[model samples]
Target: MPAYFQGLAIGLAYVAPIGMQNLFVINTALTQPRRRALLTALIVIFFDITLALFCFFGIGTVVERFALLQLLLLLCGGLIVTRIGVGLIQEEPTLDQSVEVDLPLKDVAMKACVVTWFNPQAILDGTFIFGGFRAGGVAAGESLQLILGSSSASFLWFFGITLVISLFRAHIGTKLLKAINTVCGAVLIYYGMGLFLDGVGRVQQMLSSLF
Candidate 1:
């Protein structure tokens, strides 16, 4: 397979999992108007692509070299992710028949930024995955193609999911929406706690090395 196609497959696999970015986009689609959901997806796509580039270039190497940076990211990202999950769990779901209050573009953008940039797991995973690809003996043109293909995957997946959810919005009742929120929130909290624990473990290892 061409490098572009190879990257496309990897990208799809990477983002297919139920992560913060997907949850945010899914919730937006379930609650907000189609236009707003689509816009949110675009904002998320921008962040995702930039993040992928960062990881592919050298951020992973930088983070790995700095234990302090890694610790800080894990703790901070855990707190932020857990907080977002709590917010989702506490949110009252509005029925599809009711008037939907749309979040401002700025708010949507901020949320997208948080889910993508503040997510430590995504960062580490992308960093290692993309970084490995970079470490491979691929030509410069192939590298560019890989990046483009990965970015295109983000665009397609987010937009595609948003449209699908929007089309089925009418059938999703308030209860179902609430359930979705609760489930997504719980999963996030679990993931966040795992990150925090990982940070704690890292701290212990660092301290042991010091002694």
Candidate 2:
């Protein structure tokens, strides 16, 4: 019970952060139709569980142990996220009150996977946050409980956000959509730049320690 509650709280705390993933989900919900957005949310949930499971099972330790790999992930992820952010700024959502533009199912799935899996922060969350909790053993069957609690948090948050956006979508005009794009883009770019800088700093620190 304690393990389950602990996992739930930690999971919520991680998802609550205004990071690239949350913003992407919200933006998708606002711009895309309910069906497509729901699909995207499911995909996001899948990746979240996959990552958490990987970390909880101890595979994430292998990846996180190498500082060089972490640095590389940060660099690559940062560049991709920043590029995406810039592109989002230029692309307008072609949605109106009566009309809904639904992205192809495959396209939505691919985007959801990329945005959820490739972010460096997401990697850190799995490796550091979930991995740390996983190290603290739960009761025999409690491991499953913890995983359920964490998975539930992901499902609830994504679906909840999607539902809210879907309900209010008609009231949300195009201008507001554009504004969301702009803000989300800027925030993603900032996160990317920060990731890049953090990688550079980590490398520098490693070098200094060696010298």
Candidate 3:
């Protein structure tokens, strides 16, 4: 339950979610070279941690208060994710499993940083939501160790995700990769639907609660 661990727990909840980063990471692992994938993952985690720290400190409050902001994000995110899933379903991986392409390291790193950091929800999730919870623990004068416990859990998950992706990349066959994509697509669709429903429920709940 050290402070480091506490920071890490905050890290996990943010990363473990199925989002654009996960899709990119998985796709890189399945398609690109190992080094490329690793670098991509590192960029992603670094961005997440930095954002998380920012949120926990203070920058996230603005987001937390903007009630309609999150709803708008969820709807847009759902659409984008669904769009990607549909694209995956339409294209078969094996048709172009050519191993000749290489991910431009500099570009990929820059792009990953931009995409991951620019994501509003990523900030909201890490720095605002999770960060607020951590701050409350700190404010309550909860044991630093206990407070850190959550963060450590999150850090471990980040490492675990990276390791798992790398390890699995070695053995993933073309067909298996396709299967994985299919499953991932389904997951994206489910998440999209869930988000849409949650948004609708919130509106309904707000209206009823108003009455």
Instruction: Indicate which candidate wins on lDDT.
Output: 1
TM-score of each: 0.96, 0.91, 0.71
Clashes of each: 0, 0, 14
Residue-level lDDT of model 3, residues 108-199, one tens digit each, is 87656644665545655666666667567664455455335544554465556666876767666778878878888887677666766776
**199: Cα error in model 3, Å:** 3.0
True lDDT of residue 156, candidate 3: 60
After superposition, candidate 1 runs with Cα above 4 Å error = 96-100
Question: In candidate 1, which residue pairs clash?
Answer: none
TM-score of 3: 0.71
State, as a TM-score between 0 and 1, how close model 2 is to the true structure: 0.91
Cα-based RMSD of the predictions, in order? 1.2, 1.9, 4.5
lDDT of each: 0.90, 0.82, 0.64
Error of 1 at 96 (Å): 4.2
Please provide, for model 1 over 9-29, each residue's C-alpha lDDT reduced to its tens digit, 9 standing for 90 to 100.
878977989899999999988
Write model 2 residue lDDT over 75-136, tens digit each, in one string: 88988888888988988875664776767778877777778788888878877788887676
| Model 3, CA-based lDDT | 0.64
Per the 3 Å backbone cut-off, how many clashing residue pairs does candidate 3 have? 14
